[model samples]
Target chain A: MTVKAGLKNMVLKGVNLSIGYKLHGGKVLHLQKELNMELRAGELVCLVGPNGSGKSTLIRTLAGLQKPLSGSVILDGYDISAMKVPEKSQLLGIILTERNTVDNITVFEIVSMGRYNYTNWLGTIREQDRKKISKAIYLVGLHGFENRFFGSLSDGEKQRTFIAKTLASEASILLLDEPIAQLDIPNRVEIMTFLKKLTHISDYSVLVSTHELDIALKIADKIWLIIPGDKMLIGTPDEVIKSGYLDELFGNELISFK
Target chain B: MSKKYHTTLISLLIVAVICLFFLDIILGSVTIPMRHIINILFSRTDNKGWEYIIMQLRLPRALVALFAGAGLSVAGLMMQTLFRNPLAGPYVLGISSGAGLGVAIYTMLSGIIGTGAGFIISKLNYLGQVTSAIFGAVVILIIVISIVPKVKDSVSLLIVGIMFGSLATAVISVLQFFSTPQLVQKFALWTMGSLGDVNWDQHMILSIIVITGFAVAIFLIKPMNALLLGESNAVTTGIEIKKTRYLIIISSSLIAGGLTAFTGPVAFIGIAIPHIVRMLFNSSNHKITIPMSAICGAALLLICDIISQVPGRSIVLPINVLTALFGAPVVIWIIIGKKNLRTSF
Candidate 1:
């Protein structure tokens, strides 16, 4: 056999992927490129780095929101571009930074959006659809908010409501871009920990981008330190814990973890 | 209590309506009391013109206020929910302008339809006007659909709708420039908007159109709620967002289109009444919003129509002028409300 670092369920490959766009650097306009990335399922991979490190641009390419500058994104030995939107939606559940609200919409109604792939064009919810909605709401711990007006909820509650919406998506691979950016401190911890447990206990896997280095080291099964002064590396939180990654990440002079 | 609550609202509105309708008829430019007005409506009156004034003129005008207000406002409530924008109204879709152009085109051709007579309307030509209004509204609706983006965020879509309204206005103005004096006068009069023009037959047509259109709109309650959460979110939640948006625009346009086609461009109900319903119900749920706007819109229009008349003179204000009097203030009020202001997204 061979040595493989990630958990058993996930094995994804990126073949010579080069991604970037033109950015103006005063006198000159140039392109930024990250040549490669390989992700495995069952690992909490954190894409941590500095502001202009192309972390978001990299994530955007992986999520199929943008076309790659060059190279291929292959998932489970299948070309990503060939897959249908519905099929892609089923495989990857994404939590973007955008929040959704409706006047008379309940938490359950919003979460039920995850089941659209199963519903017909006529727009009616079936029995299994209801079950999925309930499961999603329960997963996000928003049980009683089923009938609340969407606009009345607080910001933190709104974020959790979106997570509940994501849960109903029934995806095996989760991609989150700063999911806790809109949350309170307690909610941030609660949501992050809950997501971590879900990835560890279930067959699902998550790739998240965040600035919370302390929390990332504490829970992540594997850390992806997008080093400032070097190439990207994948290892455990302990291995990358004392590296200069955090110091360069925040541009702090002392380089101490609070 | 919920049953009693709606009943109480219905009862109160009905009572207010009786007072408003009587005041609109008997108190206009004359001090006829309750008994004389009853005599004018039913009994053989000594006056030659009394029956004509009460039967043909006053009664039709009152019905106009009742239907025009409720029809446009109910349409507005549905649109605001459908598009998730408080500013969406019949005017936004260019329905009024489109239908007006259609009627003007019909009026120019009214002579050919055998109804073109000076101050003496023939039934055949009048029917042509009705047909033209519906056709115009439908055609403009199709054009607007082509230009509108089916994106999730309806906030920017509102701007697109406003742009469409301006475009339609420009086209109609060009149409007006080429028309004869008589036809131009007719179009101008129609645009000023009046509840004083339609007869009993026209009223029946508008009633049927509004009732059917609103019925279709009511069926869309669940889907509209789903859409407000976001299109992708709505789609995954078992709603076909594009199909739903199409259904809603068609129904709302039909109702508002039918009304404005027959009655010119009655304004206030389409823009202001939905916000009023939101404030009163303290909820934006369509179940409450739809029916509440129906009742409240009718009442508000009846009041505005009553106010349009001089309390004791022959002076009559155009319905459009009166709606603008109230609608403009509401536009400013909406701009000042912080809840509305917070939406930059």
Candidate 2:
């Protein structure tokens, strides 16, 4: 559990990781293998490859939602693979593809829940929590719509609600799986642009699993080009983009932004 | 104030509740006058028998209807929103069946165990029934929690809950098969679901529990709203979804389990009223929805209670039968409406 020297920069660590899950037929198939990756601070990292390349599995494993077959996901040098539920929540903020519906609640109150860790066991909101919610709304560019109904929101607006909620968590690091999966084209552009802004100014690292390679290329600070045949090529976006890794990785299956 | 709009609706519901209360007091198997009941309340001299009949029989029955309505309605609202499935309610989770199974056990065992001819004539027997119902509800809740770590979809989990419900019902039917004819009559009567069995003391206890259940549900609005999106989404917002889920199931059980214990399993309001509230309020805020559901539930149940009493001459119908009459169609509408709208929950 001790923090190592080079590991100080690591927000998340997956050492010798094997990520996969049981299918509907109840068979465990390996999506990837023996991978040790360090996700650093304040970097927007994208995972891109062909269909069913285990992009989501990797995010789920690192987010502590699933158990890895081999190796460990060490968050902030702490072995989070076996951490308690509440303890795990404090270190990570996650946005998955799941859609939510609790009827008749405002976007503000929903986003404010990101402060659950900051509140007491009784779970009442504090003034500081209010401040965080306002900040998150601002970050998501949802300033005037605080009182809007979540059920009434457009898909883009709802996505922003979830993002504001994630922001309210005060998490130093985020793991997003297909953040734009439910968004329209324009909203997709806005969320990615905002995510890019988050990396530079928010001092928070984000690891996103996405099929939108073109969007990721335009925004990501770094790219973790997951080509699925060998070691993951990790470097600056310019380096990864210029190397034609995205084209070779997709192999003309129509997943690339180009 | 939008707060004022909520308050206005509550006051309107209370007014409806009061009208229903006095209406129940006046119109009964023997029709009494509004003037006479008022005189009886302040009659100075102890009109003990008449007062006892009015206070004991009529008032408690009506209040029981009110609280029972609130409890089931709130639990349904919580469950429906949490699961994001329109069909999800306390009944879907097997909580109602769990409570019914408890009643079935007591009703059947008291026969084989043959405690007495008038076993239910005593208050202790009622207490036993309540405790057993709570025990059954707790057992189902535990099973629900164990499955939480396994399943991801709220709708699929609801399906699991309903499957457990069917299992509980199947077991109860077997108990009904073995129990004596009279005991079976008692069990069947419980299933018909009336508010009449609540005497003064039982009425107070049920009221306290229902009110407390509501308080706890409103208290968890932050996490409950967080929970709407999904478990992990809630957690990412610092909501411990596991604990929040536990809180919701337990609190929902406390309400649904308690009402089912005393009043039998009343249907419809739990399933229908939250939707009505959501529709009327036009917002997705629990701050509004919680209170809105409470009022909408109370008013709706008051109307149902009045309708149940409408046989008029002497006999009264069971409230549950009347509720199911209204409830089933609303559910059908929601199902059909869901078909048309491409939306979540």
- Per-model TM-score (chain A alone): 0.86, 0.88
Off-target runs (Cα >4 Å) in candidate 1 are A1-94, A100-154, A167-175, A183-186, A200-207, A222-258, B1-66, B82-84, B103-135, B149-157, B171-185, B199-212, B230-238, B307-316, B329-345
Per-candidate TM-scores read 0.70, 0.84
> Which lDDT value does model 1 have at A238?
76
* Chain B TM-score of predicted candidate 2 relative to the true chain B: 0.87
CAPRI quality band, candidate 2: acceptable
Question: For each candidate, what is the lDDT?
Answer: 0.71, 0.76
- Positional deviation of residue B332's Cα in model 2 after best superposition, in angstroms: 5.4
Q: What 10-residue stretch in candidate 1 chain A is worst by lDDT?
A: A26-35
Residue B16, model 2, lDDT = 76
Best by DockQ: 2
Give each candidate's fraction of reference contacts reproduced.
0.28, 0.57
Per-residue alpha-carbon lDDT of model 1 for A57-90, expressed as tens digits? 6666676665677787776568776766666666
For model 2, name the residue pairs that clash. A100-B229, A104-B283, A104-B284, A104-B285, A105-B284, A105-B285, A106-B285, A114-B237
Each model's total of backbone clashes: 5, 8
Tens-digit per-residue lDDT, B1-345, candidate 1: 156766677678768767877777875665555776798776767765766777788888888888788788878876776565666786667776678768877776664443436445554555667678778888878876775554445556566666667776777677677767777787677788878878888888888888888888777776765566655455444455566777787788888998887778887678788776666545555666777777777787777888887767789888888888988887678667736422211
